[model samples]
Target: MLAKRIQPMVSQARRLYVELMFQVMGRALQAVSEVDDAVKKETQALPAGFLFEMMVMPNGPRLIVEHTGLGRLHYHGASAPRPVDLSIQFKHIAHAFLVLSFQEKTAVAFANDRMLVDGDISYAVRMTRVLNRLESFILPKLIAERAVKEYPSNLHLPHKLISAVRIYLKVATNFVETVRA
Candidate 1:
């Protein structure tokens, strides 16, 4: 049980998203003023309409990072009113939660599908490109750090990798399609 809860920390998708969001945000903010300024400025256009609910599935907490035309980055539970522009789901957000401290590697995480955007690819991609530029150079140290930080929990061989097979067998106990495929 404990392992399951903590397992997402090593998820490829979650880790990737965490790295990517930071990277993209940092990239878009370049030349705007400083990193924070760019995060604030570029996100200002995020539409005063909807909330992005990024849910890390199967009991992992939801990380809701929403922006609006109103001029600020708001986390979940903010009293601010809204019907937001896009509330894309990012399953297993905890993977992306840690170690987005840098500008460039953050972008890489997103590109890797650790952060899957669902609403509007155009806006998401545009944001991604902007963030990519701010990353002066993708350093090996950063990559190494991410790998070290994410590696221990990747229980890829059995549970995760073979989940499909096990679940199929369980569900298909009486079906022929289970073996046919």
Candidate 2:
């Protein structure tokens, strides 16, 4: 009985965390694309109206973000009925948080059997590149280096710092809007 009672609370917390991860990631992607031409170019080949999601297992929590042209990435509301083109589902909530917290790279996590991908492999690879670009902009150099396979040698610190601030500001604004809505 105690286990049953605690399970729901744990599930709720995991769902909230997963939702927050998506919100921050969506804003970071938008911010990076705005300031980095390389990132914009990387996303150019993605099919328009592509919807992607990272979800926790067993109906725990899901976040959907859509890629529109010109760096406009928007978080699709939980209630939105759009079909996801690419869905990365974590086998467990803890594993999902591990990737979100940067302790595990997405590719590494996938390779380690921590998650499942339900979509086109080619598109998923493209999306991974986009995500690596966003991490370069938002994460600290030390963390980004570990999270990405190859941290660019020419990525200047000052530029990265400036972009990080912009990404954080956008994420905060998005968070506020989400809370208000």
Candidate 3:
């Protein structure tokens, strides 16, 4: 009886998720292509359109940026919303690439596993060079400020002390790890 009650809703949610993904992928491709074109102009050695792939794991994402020609660079993953492109894990990765800071060393360490690399190094190097060129100037920022916005004026009192304790424990664990390192 419970299964019958939930099945239709689950199907509807799945359909909605797919529709939204297509929308996001479409927009991301446009942004990537535009950035690539502009970067190529400033850097002479930049790839035209690359077909690089990435093997991103929980620890980090490995980039394999490739060039299809003199005009574009491709990262490995699902075909982006463009002509020459990199493939993203599609389900999990595209969002991470958009959000995570590249400053962390652990992320770079995960990328060093050669077995994860299934494609061209020249392409990855070329795309990396293009990204370096783009890095010179600040790219347009996409912030999720509103998503995490807190209404300080409308704050709610905690319903349970246990929940607060849990938060503290998590923070303590993180602190200890940092101190030990």
Candidate 4:
């Protein structure tokens, strides 16, 4: 009986955690596009107004990022008002939680058939590269190494530290603006 009751609570908590992770990731991507040259260059490769979405199937948390002109990105919250250029949908919330929590690398999740991708494969690849770069900026080296396919060897400590600080500051400011709006 206790196991049955606890299961629901655990599932709900996982859902909430996934939702929060999506939000933070959206903000972090936005920060990365604005502050990281490599990310900006990647975004520039995407067409202006391009929208990319990542979500869990059956109405779970969603994140949408748009490639605004001028090599910038905008986080459009959990919904897409317009059709997205690329959409990555996890088969279940558990799969999404696993990937978001760094228990699974994205390629591993894809290999395990944990998610589905819609739209251009090339665009998805580009977005993955951007996400990897963004992760390197925001996550600790140890965690980032696990989250990304490979930690960038060229990113020396000083550069990583400075970029991380700037990106985090942008994320905070974006969060405040989001709360206000």
Which candidate has the highest lDDT of all? 4
**lDDT (Cα, tens digit) per residue for candidate 2, span 10-103:** 8788667777777677667766766677877877777778888877787857767677876556667553457788987899888887888788
By TM-score, who's the top model here? 4
Worst 10 residues of 4 by lDDT: 34-43
Query: Is 2 or 4 the stronger prediction by lDDT?
Result: 4
lDDT of 3 by residue, 1-181 (tens): 9999998886666445544433333333323434445445433354455444443344333334444454543323333344434333323343333333332222242353322333454544543444333322222212222211221222223412332334334435534654697
Clashes of 3: 26
- lDDT of candidate 4 over 21-118, digit per residue (tens): 99989999988888888888878988999999999997889999999987799999998979998999999999998888998988888889999989
Tell me the TM-score of model 3. Answer: 0.32
C-alpha TM-score for every candidate = 0.39, 0.83, 0.32, 0.97
Each prediction's RMSD over C-alphas, in Å, is 18.5, 2.9, 17.7, 0.9
Q: Candidate 1: global Cα-lDDT?
A: 0.43
Backbone N/Cα/C clashes per model: 24, 0, 26, 0
lDDT, model 1, position 106: 44
Clashing pairs in 2: none
lDDT sort, best first: 4, 2, 1, 3
